[model samples]
Target: MSRQSIVTAGVLDAALVLLFAAIGRLSHGETLAGLGVTAWPFLGGLIIGWLLLRAWRHPLSVVWTGLGIWIATVAGGLLLRLAGGQGVQLSFAIVTTIVLGIFLLGWRAIAALVRRTSRKRMPAPV
Candidate 1:
């Protein structure tokens, strides 16, 4: 992948993690002012995922990079939250897994589909 694609994937992953935190906080009647407190664990997990998977090399691979990152983001986030003395209920973990899986992997799936369709539309080489 190009440098730009790698950077974009990383940024988008972070943004999705933040969005997950923000939604959870808002649903609990928490203020946006506490967003950093809510987001940091999952963001940390996202970084860990990127590093562990060397995700930049295949940033858009839905099965490879995306699956590993999603797993890391959920598992690492829950572990970090536990370490930080934050609530880490089973239901919360389940929700986090489902949501982050959707957020991290969903985009890559869409992008893959788009690339496939666009390739089919391109004219044959001379």
Candidate 2:
């Protein structure tokens, strides 16, 4: 992938993680002022995921990159939160896994679908 595409994927992943934090905070009546506190663990996990997977090489691969990112973001985030004295309730972990799976992998799946459709529509070389 191009450098821009790699950067875009990283940024998008980070933004989605931040959005998840914001949504959770808002739902629980928490102030946005503490959003960084909520988001940092997951964001750190996201970075770890990307680096471990060398995701930039196949940034849009749902199975290869996205799956790893989802797993790492959840697992790593939980560990970090636990270490930081944050709540790690079973229910919260379940919700986090489900939500982050969708948030992190959903976009790549959609992108793959769109790319497949576009390729089908493109004229083949004679």
| Candidate 2, pairs of clashing residues | none
Model 1 residue-pair collision total: 0
Q: Over 4 Å off in model 1, which ranges?
A: none
How do the residues 1-126 of candidate 1 rate in per-residue lDDT, one tens digit apiece? 799999999999999999999999999999999999989989998999999999988999999999999998888888999999998989999999999999999999999999999999999999
Q: Against the true structure, whose lDDT is highest?
A: 2
Candidate 1 at 26: error in angstroms? 0.7
Error of 1 at 81 (Å): 0.4
In model 1, what lDDT does residue 90 have?
93
Span of 10 residues, lowest total lDDT, candidate 2: 1-10
Compared with the true structure, what per-residue lDDT tens digits does model 2 show for residues 1-126?
889989999999999999999999999999999999999999999999999999999999999899999999999999999988999999989999999999999999998999999999999999
Local error of candidate 2 at 120, Å? 0.5
Candidate 2 residue-pair clash tally: 0
